[model samples]
Target: MPELPEVEGVVRDLRPIVEGKTIAQVALSETVFTSHDAGKQTIVKNNEPHQFERLIQQMTIIELKRRSKYIFFQLEKDGETFHLINHLGMTGAWFVVNDITEITEDKFRKHIHAVFTLTTGELLVFSDIRRFGELRFIKEIEEHPPLLKMAPEPFDEDACDFFITQSEKPKYRNKPIKEVIMDGQVISGCGNIYATESLFKMNIHPGRKTNRISRERKQQLFQVICDVLQESINSGGSTISDYRSINGGAGTMQHRLKMYGKKQCLTCDTTTKSIVIAGRTSTYCPKCQR
Candidate 1:
């Protein structure tokens, strides 16, 4: 799945292309993409963009922000309001094209799931072969249930609060730290890949009880999550053999991973093993992580 870093990269690449441009087209080809906003009409070729233009043609993109793995676009008007939200689940990607001709067969014919044409003549295309991504509009951004339910993100105060709460939660008292972190309610944006990487980096056993971890270990774990997330963003996020950035480029972070998917520890050259935590495979150097 595309994590926070991968999604943030997409937001970065999309800002200049569609920031000031009006919506010439809002076309969605997949039904699953509508799951983000209940009852949103599936965007066909000619239906919604005209209506969308009446609603938001001259409006400017005031800000672009992210919550967890979801990218939120704050579009503003003096008298009207609308928000654009995007979620790239597994195989989703965005494409920026100066012209429709710039959109290649691989981007349009093969994987294209949605397209948002900007007034500037540029095309912001969304493609997800897995049909797990989402593009939706909302009246008040804060009213969206999914976004509202999300805990604090990487740098927010809510994240720190969530960390402390999760550490004390009775349900997690005997559960492995990996399982604890994998729960989105406990820590948003931590998918299986990051959960494993975070645990390995902190030298914590995946099966260790969350409540039993030491204060030093908690501090180390917190910093590693931030470090790993920032590093992944710099590398455009791990491709995970599926996701790509907004430029349709594969991420390079996978090559720098220390623990996940390796048969041996790259840092210490110790033999590694995989263990199942909450039904997901986690790899660690038994010698190092214990």
Candidate 2:
């Protein structure tokens, strides 16, 4: 899944390509409105395909923003402001091209599920092989439930304090440090890869109880999280398996990863270990991570 950095990079790149361009036509695959294809849910949510097309076809994109792992498209039509949201769950990717047949990447060209044809003669293509991603049109953001639980962005001023406060809650005291940071209510946009790397940097084990971590360490962890996310955004975000930029470029951050998928710690030369927390694998150096 594309985390904050990945989604942020995509949103940044998509702005110049898509913003201000009117969607002349909205094309959706049959797989979008149909039932699950091999356990996948309907990719286009919130309305039927024709209704979604009716609402979005002529809307002009004004701006694009990222929240956590989601993308928000600020749209306008006849002086009315509306919103469209996209969540790239696991395998989703976007591409901007003049012609889809000119696409060279197999995964991108073959799995395209939605195409937003712009009056600018460019097509904004959405492809998701796993079909876990979703696109929705809504009048207001508050209509979605998940956005309501999103905490402050990791780089926001009060995010660290919010993290500390959320950690102190009785229900979260016993939660693993890994799980705590990944909690949407505790901190936004810290996903499995970033959480694992941040823990490795802070020398805190993933399974360490949240209450056992000092407030100072939690503060430092928040800063490290910000740093990691910033570094990733700078590096164009990590491309572990399926993440790609709007132009089809893969991120180089994977080469800079320290602990996420290593067999040995580069710092201590200690053998690394793996554990599953919340069904995600966390790789850490036993000697390097406390």
Candidate 3:
């Protein structure tokens, strides 16, 4: 899954190309973007193919932003505004291409399900092999329950405080620190890969209970998470699998990974230990991490 850095890269890449430009055409090859909240799969939530076409075509993209792992497209036409919220679940990606024939990657070629041609003469293509990606067009983002319930962005001034307060809560105190940080409602945008790296860097065991750790340690871990995420973004985000930038460039962060999928500890030279937490594989240096 594309986490904060990856999603932020997409937002930054897309903002320049899509914002202030009207969409010229919207084409779907039987494409359906789903919403876990409504459990419906049309183009977006309630809009059918034709309806979605009518709603988005010719609307100028006002802005593009990222919250957690979601990409937001602010659209407007005739003084009416609507938000297109996209979650690139699992294998989903957006590509900028001048022509579909320019695509050479086999995964993107095979999974090019939706195409949004902009009036600027460029094309925005969406490819998702697993179909777990979501694109919803709504009046406002917070109106959606799932989006509404999301924690503040990790860069928010109060995000660390929120994490600490949530960690000290009765329900989360007993939870593993790995799971606590991975929770979207607790700390948005840090997922399994980033959390594992953060824990390893902070010398904290992934399975350490939240309450067992001191408040100072928790604050340190939060800072480590931010550093790891920022580093990944600087490297264009990790291409753990098929993650790519809008220009179809792969991220180099995977080459710099210290944990997550390592066999031997780079620091202590001890064999790494692995566990399943929050339904994701977490690897840590046994001798290095406490």
Candidate 4:
């Protein structure tokens, strides 16, 4: 799955190409993006049939925002009327090109499922071999999922408070730290990759209970989570699997990983091991993370 860092990388690569441009065309294959919010999809297609056409030659993209893994485009046309929200679920990605290049099955091969053309003569493509990505139109941005209920981005006071509140919850107190972090309600956007890396950074056992976690350790965990996430973004995100930047480039962060997919610890050179927690694989160094 594309975690927050990987998604952030795509956002960075996309902003420059799609920011000031107008949508020229919108295309979708037979598969429809479905979830708890099924109604919005139709709303998007109906409300903007001409879609990128009007914007292609007229409007300008004012700003871009991300909530959890969803990316929202703030289109400015005299005032804030409507904006486009896109979610790249697992195996989904956006590709930008400078010309009307022919999209061969070889480009993304079978992964190319949707395409959007911009007025700047650039082609914005979406490829999701699994058909899990979604696009929606919104009059009010907060209707989106991550923006609607997710905790603040990383270090906001609201996010910090939310983190503390979740960590202290009685029912979750006995769960392993990785399980707690991966709990979307506790903090959105964390996945198996970050869950493992964050615990390893803070030297906390992945199996440690939330109740048993010390206040100092909690503070440390908070810092490490932010640090690790920011570092991943700076490094362009990990691309060990289907993840790729919007520019069709691979991320280099996987080279700096401490212990996610490796069998040996990068720090102490001990053999990395794993155990099952909350139905997900938990990897760590027994020597570094107690």
User: In model 2, what is the error at residue 91, expressed in angstroms?
Assistant: 1.1
Model 1, span 116-211: residue lDDT tens? 667676777777777666666677756656667666786775676577677777877678888877776667778877777888888888888887
lDDT values of the candidates? 0.72, 0.88, 0.85, 0.73
lDDT string, candidate 2, 131-242, tens digits: 8888989998789888888899888898899999999999799989999899888999889999989999999999899999999999999999999999999999998887
What lDDT would candidate 4 get against the real structure?
A: 0.73
Question: Highest lDDT, which number?
Answer: 2
- Residue pairs with backbone overlap in model 4: 22-55, 23-52, 105-109
Using lDDT, rank the candidates from best to worst: 2, 3, 4, 1
The regions of model 1 sitting more than 4 angstroms off are 30-60, 104-109
> What global local distance difference test value does model 3 have?
0.85
Per-residue lDDT of 204-252 in model 4, one digit per residue for the tens? 8899888888867887787788888888888888887776677568888
Candidate 3 scores a C-alpha RMSD against the true structure in Å of: 2.6
Which one wins by lDDT: 3 or 4?
3
Worst 10 residues of 4 by lDDT: 35-44
Clashing pairs in 2: none
Candidate 3 TM-score, C-alpha based: 0.93
TM-score of each: 0.83, 0.96, 0.93, 0.83
Compared with the true structure, the alpha-carbon lDDT of candidate 2 equals: 0.88
